[model samples]
Target chain A: MFWQQLVNGLTLGSTYSLVALGYTLIMGVLNIINMAHGEVFMFGAFVGLFLVNYLKVNIFVAMAGAMAASALLGILLEMLALRPLRRRAVSDLAPLISTIGVSIFLENLALKIFGPQSQAFPAGALSGVQLQLGPIRITLVQIVILGISFGLMFVLRFWLSKTRVGKAIRTTAESIETANLLGINTNKIILLTVALASALGGIAGVLVGLSINAVEPTMGLSMGLKGLAVLILGGMGNITGAMLGGLILGIAEVFTVAYGASSYRDAVAFGIIILILFIRPQGLFGKRQGGRF
Target chain B: MDIILNQYYLQIVIFVLVNAILGVSIYMTLSTGQLSLGNAGFMSIGAYTCAILTVKAGFPVYLAIPIGGAAASFISLIIGYPALRLTGIYLAIATLGFGEVVRVIILNLKITNGALGISGIPTLGTKISKMLSSFGLSRFGGLTAQQTSNLLVLVVLIFILAFLVFFCTRLNRSRVGRAFASIKADESAAEAMGINTTYYKLLAFALGAFIAGMAGGLSAHLTFFIGPKDFAYHRTVEILSFAVLGGSDLIIGPIVGALLLTMLPELLRSASEYRLMIYGALMVIMMAFRPQGLISKETVRFWKRKLGRRINQ
Candidate 1:
C-alpha cells in the first residue's frame, strides 16, 4: 500500500513541480505572482482537450498547440494587466490585483463558453495497460505523466543554463537594471519569461487533465493555490526548491490520505506549511534576509 | 418605487452593509501594511460560532453575535503573532493556507453539520423583537413581522456601520493610526522611529478579524442557511475587490466600493450570463487606470480643490 501510494504521490508531485516551476520562473524575473497563472493552465488544458477530443489530434500535437496558445495568453496577460501597472510605477500589489482581475475574467469566460461542468477525455485516450510489480500497481497513464513532467523539467533546466537567451533571462532575474545596463532588452526578456513560464503552466494543466481524465473551469483555482504553496515550500524563486517542495507536498498528501483519515488530506498540506512557516519564514530553501518592506 | 421597503433593495442594502463591514475589516489590516487573505476564515469562525450558539446553546442573537466576534478575534491573536512575522506574499500565502485549513476543519466538524450546513437559523430581527417584547419594550410593534425584521436589520446594520465608520475615521488620525500609516509607508523606517511594529500589526489584524466576525454573525441571520461554502477562497477575493475598487487609502473608500459592487450585478441583470465576466474586466480596467482605487486621498483632495474654487468663483 505504501509503495503504491509513493508512486501515486510521485506522479502527482511531478505535476506540482511543473506548476511550481512556472511560479518560480515568473517570481525570479518579475518578482510578481502571476495570479492568472492558474487560468492560463486551465486554458491550456481546455485547448488540449479541444484538440484531442474535437479534432482527434494526438496528445503530442495537442500539448504543443496548448503550449503555443498559453504562451500567447501569457504575453497578453503581461501586456494588458502587468505592463501598464509596471509602466505607471504603481504599487507592487497592483499587478497582483490586476492579474486577479484577469483570472476572474478568464474563469467566467470559460464558464460561459464551456458551461459549469467537467468535460471528460474520451475513453482509450491512452492505452489502459496496468503494470503490476509485485504488490505495487502502476498504470500507463501515470508513467506517461511522470515521463513528460521530468522531460519538461530537464529541458527547462538545460534551456535556462546552456543557451545565450537562457543566460540573459538569468541576468534579468538577477538584476533587471544591471541586465539593461549590459545591453539586454529587459522588456523582451520579461515577455519571454512570462511566455516560457505560462507555457510550462499550460503543459502542467494538460498532464493533470490527462491523468484525471477530465477538465473543468474551476480546476485552476485549487491547483493554482497549491502551486503557490509549492512555490513557497521550494523557497520562492528557487527552481530546485520548487521541484523538491512539490514532491514533498505530494508525498505528504498521499501518505496522509492513505494512513490518516481522508478528510484531513487537504488540511495536512496547509498544516505542515503553517508549521514550516513558523520555523522558517524564508521557506526551506530561501535565503534569510529582511523582507522587501 | 418604494426602494427602501422593497424586499430586493432592502436585501441588497443589507448585503452592502455587511460587505462594507468586511471591506473595512480588510482595510484595517491593509492600513497597517499587512495584506490578509484570511478574513474569510475569521468570518466563517464567527458565522459558525454564532450559528451554533443561537441554534444549540440557546443564546440570543445580540449576545451570540458578540461572542462570535470574540471567538474569531481570539483565533486571530493566536495566529497573528507568528503569521505577521512574515511580510508581503509570505503573509498572504500563510493566511490563505489558514483560510483553507479553517474551511476543511469546518467541513469535517459535526457541529457544522459537515457540509450540509445549519439551516433554518432564526432571523436576527425576529429574535431581537421577541426578546425586547418579552421585556415589555415594543420598538417594532407597529409593523408586520417581516417588515419589522427587515427594518430592524437595516437599523442595526446602519448603526454598526456608523460606529465603524466613525471609529475608522478617528483611527485614521490617532497615534496608532499614524503608526499604521508610517509602517505602511516604510516598515523598517517605522521600526527605526521607535514604533512597536509587531504590536500594532497584531492589533490591526485582530481588529480586522473582529470586524469580519461581526459581519459574519450578522450575515448568518440575514441568510437562512450558513455553510462552509459561504466563506470560501473566492469570497476573500471578493472582499479584497471591495477595498481595491473603492480605494484602501480612505475610510469611505471600501463603503463606496461595497455599495457600488453590490448594486453592479443587479444593474447588469439584463446581461446576467455575462455579469461576472464584465465585473472581472472592470477590475482589470479599474486597476489599470486607477490602481490607487476609486477614492484615494488624492481624489478627495482633487474634488475638494475643485469644489472650493467653484464656490469662490
Candidate 2:
C-alpha cells in the first residue's frame, strides 16, 4: 500500500514539478509571475486533444504541437500585454492584475469555444496497460510520464549549466541589469525564457490530461493554485526547489489522504505551505533577495 | 409592471447598495497597499452570523445585523495581526487560503445547514421603506410593501454609502492614513520613520474586514437569505475586480467600479453565457490601457486636460 501510494505520489509530483519548472523559470528570469500560465497549459492540452482527434496525429506529435502552439501564445501574451506594461513603468500590481484578466479571458474563451462539459481524451491508447511489482501496480503511462519528466529536467539542468543561451538565461535570472551590461539581449532572453517555460507548461498539461483522462476550463484554477503552492514550497524562482517541493507536496498529500480523510487533501497541502512559510518564508531552497516588502 | 416595480427593481437597488458596500469595504485595505482576498469569506461570516442569529436565536433584525458585523470583525482582528506581517502577494495568498479554509469549515459545520442552505428567514424587501429613504426622510419606520417604502430604504442605503465615502475621504487625509501610505510606499522606510508598521497594517486589514462584515450583514438583511455560495471565490474576484477596475487608490473608484460592474451584468443578461467572457476581456483591456483604473485621479486629470484645451479654444 505504501509503495503504491509512493509511486502515485511520485507520478503526480513529477507532473507538478514540470509545471513548477515553468513557473520558476519565468519568475526567476523575468521576476514576473505568469498568472496565465495555467491557462496556457490548459490550452496546450486542448491543442493536443485537437491534434489527436481531428488530425489523427500520434501522441508524441500531438504533444510537440501543443508545446509549440503554447510557446507562441506565451510570446504573444508577452509582446502584447507584458511588453507594453514593462515599457510604461507601471506598478507590479498592474501586470499581475492584467495577467489575471488575461487568465480569466482565456478561461471563458475556452469555455465558450469548447463547451462547459468536461472533455475526455481517447483513453484506450494510454490506459489498460498496468505494470505490477509485488502488490504495487503502476501503469505504462505512469512510467512514460516519469521518464519524460525526468528526461526534461535533466535536459534543462544540462542546458542551464552548459549552453550559451543557458548561461544567458542564468545570468538574466541572477541580475537582468547586469546581464544587459554583459552584452546579452535581455529582452530576447526574456522572450526566450517565457517561450521555454510556456512550452514546458504545455507539455506538462498534455501529460497530466492524459493521466487524468479529463480536462475542463476550470481545471486551471486548482492546478494553478497547486503549482503556486509547489513553487512556494520549493522556494520561488528555484528550479530544483520546485522539483523537491512538488515531490514533497505530492507525497505528503498522498500519505495524508491515505491515512486521513480524502476531503482534507487540499487542506493538508495548504497547511504544509503555511507551516513552511512560518518556519522559512524564503522556501526550502530559495535564496533571499534584498528587497523590502 | 407592478410586479416588476415591486420585485425586480427593488432587488436591483438592494443588490447595488450591498455590492457598493462590499466594493468600498474591499477598497479600504486596497488603499492601504494591502490585498485581502478573503473579503467574501468575511462577508460570509457576517451573513451566516446574522442569518443564524435572526432565524435560530430569535434576535431582532437590527441587533442581529450589528452582531453579525461584529462577529466578522472579531475574526479579522484575531487573524489580522499574524497575517498582516506578510506583504503584497504573500498577504493575498494567505488571505486566499483563509477564505478556502472558511469555506471548508462552513461546508462541514452543522449550523450552516451544509449545502442545503438556510431558508424561511423573514424578508426585508418592502417597497415603502425603500421609497421613504430615497426621498431623504431619514427617521421613517420600516415600511411595508408600499412602493414609497422600498424607495426609502434604497435612499437610506445610498445616504449611508455617501457618508461612508465622506468618512473614508477624510480618513485618507489623516495622519493614520499617511502612515498607511508610507507603509504602502515602503514598509521598512515607514518603520524607519517611526511609524508602527505592524499596527497600521493590522488596522488596515481589520477595518477592511469590518466594513465587509457590515456589507454582508446588510446583504443578509436585504435578501433574507445566507449561504456559503454567496461568498465563493468568484465573489472575491468580483470584489477585487471592482476595486482594481475602479481604481484602488481613490475613495470614489471602488464605488464607481462596483456600481458600473454590478449594473453591467444586469445589462448584459441577454448575453449571460458570454457575460464572464466580456467581463474578462474588458478587464484585460482596462489593465492594458488604463492600469490606474477608470476613475483614477490621473484619468480625471487627463479628462480635465482635454476639457481645458477645449475651453481654451
Candidate 3:
C-alpha cells in the first residue's frame, strides 16, 4: 500500500513539477508571476483534446499542436499586457493584477466557447491499458505521464546548459542590464523564456489531461495555484528546487490524505507552504531575496 | 423612492454595501503598503462564527455579529505577524495560501456543515419590518412586512458603510495614516523616522479583518445561508478587483470600485453569459490605461469641478 501510494504521489508530483518549471522560469528571468499561466495550460489541454477527439489525430500530434499554441499565447501575453506595464515601470503588483484580468478573460472566454463541462478523451490506453507489478500496480496513463514529464525536464536542463539561447537566458536572469550590455537582445530572451516555459506548461496540461481522462475549463485555477506553491517551496526561481519541491509536496499531500481526511489535501499543501514561508522564507535551496525583487 | 424599497433594488443595494465593506478592508491593507489577497478568508471566519452563534448558540443577531468580528480580528492578529514580514508578491501569496487553507478546513469541519452549509439563518430583516411598521412607513411603499424587513438590511448596512467611509477618511488624515503612507513609500525610511512599522502593519490587518468580519456577518444574514464555497478564492479575486478597479490611493476608491463593479454585472445581466467576459475585459483595459484606479484625488477634484460647473449652469 505504501509503495502504491508512493508511485501515485510521484506521478502527481511529476506533473506538478512540469507546471512548476514554467512558473520558476518566468519568475527567474522576468521576476513576475504569470497569473494567467494556468489558463494557458487549460487552453493547451482543450487544444490537445480537440486535436485528439475531434480531428482524430495521434496523441503526439495533439501534444505538439497544444505546445505550439500555448507558446504563441505566452508570447502574446508578454507582449500585450506585461510589456506595456514593464515599459511604464508600474508598481510590482500592477502586472500581477493585470495578468489576473487576462486570466479571468480567458477563463470566461473558454467557458463560453467550450462550455462548462469536462471534455473526456475517447477510449484509448488511458483507460484500458494497465501495468501490473508485484504489490505496486501502475497504469499505462501513469507511465506516459511520468515519461513525458521527465523527458521534458531533461530536455529543458540540457537546453539551459548546452545551448547559446540557454546561456543567454541565464545571463538575463542574473542581471538584465548586464545581459543587455553583453550585446544580448533582452527582449528576445524574455520572449524565448516565456515561450519555452509555456511550452512546458502546455506539455504538462496534455499529459495531465490524458491521465485524468477529461479536460475542463476550471482545471487550471487550482493546478496553477498548486504549481505556484511548488515553485515557492523548491525555492522561487530555482529549477532543480522546483522539481524536488513538487515531489515532496505531492508525497505530503498523499500521506495527508492517507492518514487524515481526504478533504484536507489542498489544505495540507498550503499549510506546509505557510510554515516554510515563516521559518525559512527563502526556501530550501533559495538564497535570501535581497529585497530588490 | 417606492421602487427603491422594492425587493430587487434592496437586494442590489445590500450587495453593493457588502462589497463596499469588503473593498474597504482591502483598501486599508493596500494603504499600509501591503497587497493582501486573503480578506475572503477573514470574511469566512466572521460569517461562520456569526452563523454558528446565531444558529447553535442562540445568540441575538446584534450581539453575535460583534463577537464574530472580534473572532476574525483575533485570527488576523495571529496571521498578520509572519504574513506581514514578506513584501509584495510573497506577502500576497502567503495570504492567498491562508485563504485557501481556511476554505479547505471549513469544508472538512463538521461545524461548518461540511459543504451543505448553514441555512435558515436569522437576520435583521424582521426587526426592520417591525420598526417600519412602528413608524407607519410600511404602508408608504405597499411593501409587505417581509419586504420591509428585507429592505431594512439595506438601510442598516448602508449606515455601516457610511460609518466606515467616515472612519477611514478620518484615519487617513491622522498621524497613523501618515505612518501608513511613509511605510508604503519605504519601510526602512518609515522605520528610521521612528514609525513602528510592525505595529502599523499589524493594525492594518486587524482593522481590515474587523471590517471584513462585519461584512461577512451581514452577508450571512442577508443571504440566509453560509457556505464554504461562498468564501473561496473567487471572493478574494472580487475583493481585490474592487481595490484595483476603484483605486487604492484614496479613501473612497475601493468603495467606488465595489459599488460600480457590483452594479455593472447586474446592469449587464441582459448579456448574461457575456457579463464576466465584459467585466474581465474592462479590468484589463482599466489597468492597462489607468493603473492608479478611478477615484484618485486628482480625478475626484476633476469630477467635483465638472459637477460644480454643471450646477452653476
Candidate 4:
C-alpha cells in the first residue's frame, strides 16, 4: 500500500512540478505571481482535448499543439496585461490583481466555449495498459507522465545553465537593471520567459488530464492553488526547490487521501502552505532567514 | 416612495448596502497596506456563529450579531499574529488559503449542514414584515409581505453601513490611522520611528474581520439562509474589488465602488453572460490606466476642499 501510494504521489508530484516551474520562472524574472497561470494550464488542456477529439493525434503531438498554443497565449498575456503595467511601474500588487483579471477572463471564456462539464481526456493507447511489477501496479500513462516531466525538467535545467538566452534570462532575473546595463533586451527576455513558463504549464495540464482522464474549466483553480503552495514550499524562484516542493506536496496529499478523508485533500495542501508560511516563510531552499515569507 | 421601496428595488438597495459594508471591511485592511483577501473567512465565521446561535441556541438577533462579530474578530486576532509576519503577496496568499480552509471545513461539518447548507432559519426580513403588520402600516395595503421584509433588510443594512462609515472615519483619523498610513509608506521606517508595526497590523486585521463579521451576521438574517458556497474566494475578490476599483485611499472609495459595481451588471442585463467578461476587462484596463482606482487622493482632497469651502460660505 505504501509503495503504491508512493508511486501515485510521485506521479502526482511530477505534474505539480510542471505547474510550479511556470510560477517559479515568472517569479524569477517578473517579481510578480502570474495568478492566471492555472488558466493557461487549463487552456492548454482544452487545446489538447480538441486536438485529440478532432485531429486524431497522439498524446505527444497533442502536447506539442498545446505547448505552441499556450506559448502564444503567454506572449499575449505579457503583451496585454503585464507589459502595460510594467510600462507604468505600478505597485507590486497591481500585477497580481491584473493577472487575476486575465484569469477570470480566460476562465469565463473557457466556460463559454467548453461549457461547465468535465470532458473526457483522450488517453489514446495509454489507457488500457497497466503494468504490474511484483507487488506494485503501475501504468504506462504514469510512466509516460513521469518520463516526460523529468525529461522536460532536465531540458529546462540544461537550457537555463547552458544556452545564451538562458544566461540572459538568469541575468535578468538576478536584476533587471543590471541586465539592462549588460545590453540584454529585457522586454524580449520577459516575453520569452513567460512563454516558456506557460508552455510548461500547458504540458502539465495535458499530462494531468491524461493521468486523471478528466478535464474541466475549474481544473485550474485547485491546481493553481496547489502549484502556488508548492512554489512557496520549495522556495520561491528556486527551480530545484519547486521540484522538491512538488514531490513533497504530492506525497503529503496522497497520504492524506489514504489516511484521512478524500475531501481533506485540498485542505491539507493549503494547510501545509499556511504552516510553512508561519514556521519558515523563506522555505527550504530560500536564501533569507525564517521570517521573510 | 412606493415605487422606490418595491420588493425588487429594495432587494437591490439592500445588497448594495451589504456590499458597501463588505467593501469597508476590506478597505480597513487595505488602508493599513495589508491587502488581505480573506474577509470571506471572517464572514463565514460570523454567519455560521450567528446562525447557530439563533437557530439552535435560541438567541435573539440583536444579541447574536455582536457575539458573532466578536467570535470572528477573536479568530482574526489569533490568526493575524502569525499571518501578518509574511509580507506582500505572501500574506495575501496565506489569507486566501485561510478563506478556502474555512469553506472546506464548513463543507464537511455536520452543524453547518454540509453541502446542503442550513435553511429555513428566520431572517430580519420576517421580523420587519411582522412589525409592519402590527403597526397597521399594511392597512395602506400596497406593500406586500415581500416588500415589507425587503424594506426591513434595507433599513438594517443602511444602519450597518452608516455605523461602519462613522467608525472607519474615526479609526482613520486617530493616531492609529496615522500609524497605518506610515506603515503603508514603509514598514521598516514606521518601525524605526517607534510605531509598533505588529500591533497596528493585527489591529487593522481584527477590525476588518470584525466589520466583515458584522456584515455577515446581518446578511444571514436578511437573506434567511447561509451556505458555505456563499463565502468562497471569489466573494473575497468581489469585496477586494470594491476597494481596488473604487479607490483604496479614501473612506468613501470602496462604498461608492461597491455601489457602482453591484449596479453595473443589473444595468447591462442585455448581455448577462458577458457582464463578467466586461468586468474582468475593465479591471485589466483600470489597472493599466488608473491603478489608483476611480477615486484618488486628489479627487478626495478636491472634494474635501469644496465641501469645506461650501460650509465656510
Q: Kindly give the number of clashing pairs for every candidate.
A: 1, 22, 0, 0
Model 2, span B56-107: residue lDDT tens: 9998766777788788888988777777777776667667767767776777
Q: Score every model by TM-score.
A: 0.97, 0.91, 0.95, 0.96
Q: Which parts of model 3 have CA positions greater than 4 angstroms off?
A: A125-127, A290-293, B130-143, B301-313
Clashing pairs in 1: A234-A241
The weakest ten consecutive residues by lDDT in model 4 chain B span: B137-146
How is the predicted docking of candidate 4 categorized under the CAPRI scheme? medium
Report the C-alpha lDDT of model 3 over A78-194, residue by residue, as the tens digit: 888778787776788988888888888888899889898998878862566777899999988888888888888888889988999899999999889999999999999999999
What is the alpha-carbon interface RMSD for each candidate? 1.7, 1.9, 1.3, 0.9
lDDT of 3 by residue, B1-313 (tens): 5666667877888789899999989999999879888899999999999989999999888878878888889999998898788888988889899999999898888889988999989777875666667877664456676666766677788888899989988998999998999999899999999999999999998999998988899899888898998998778888888888889999789989988888887887777567666666766777788998988878988989999999999
Poorest lDDT segment (10 consecutive residues) of candidate 2 chain A:
A284-293
TM-score of predicted structure 1: 0.97
Candidates ranked, most accurate by TM-score first: 1, 4, 3, 2
* Residue B106, candidate 4: C-alpha displacement in angstroms: 0.8
User: Which pairs, if any, clash in model 4?
Assistant: none
lDDT of 4 by residue, B213-248 (tens): 988988898777899989986688778777878989
Candidate 1 C-alpha lDDT tens digits along A28-113? 89898888889999999999999999999998888999999999999999899888887777767777778888988899899989
Off by over 4 Å in 4: A123-125, A289-293, B131-142, B303-313
**Model 2, range A183-258, lDDT digits (tens) per residue?**
9999999999999988998898889888888888877766776777787788878888988888888888788888
Q: Report the Cα lDDT for residue A279, model 3.
A: 87
Error of 1 at A134 (Å): 3.4
Instruction: Give the C-alpha miss distance for residue B130 in model 3, angstroms.
Output: 4.1
- Candidate 1 deviant stretches above 4 angstroms: A289-293, B1-4, B135-143, B271-273
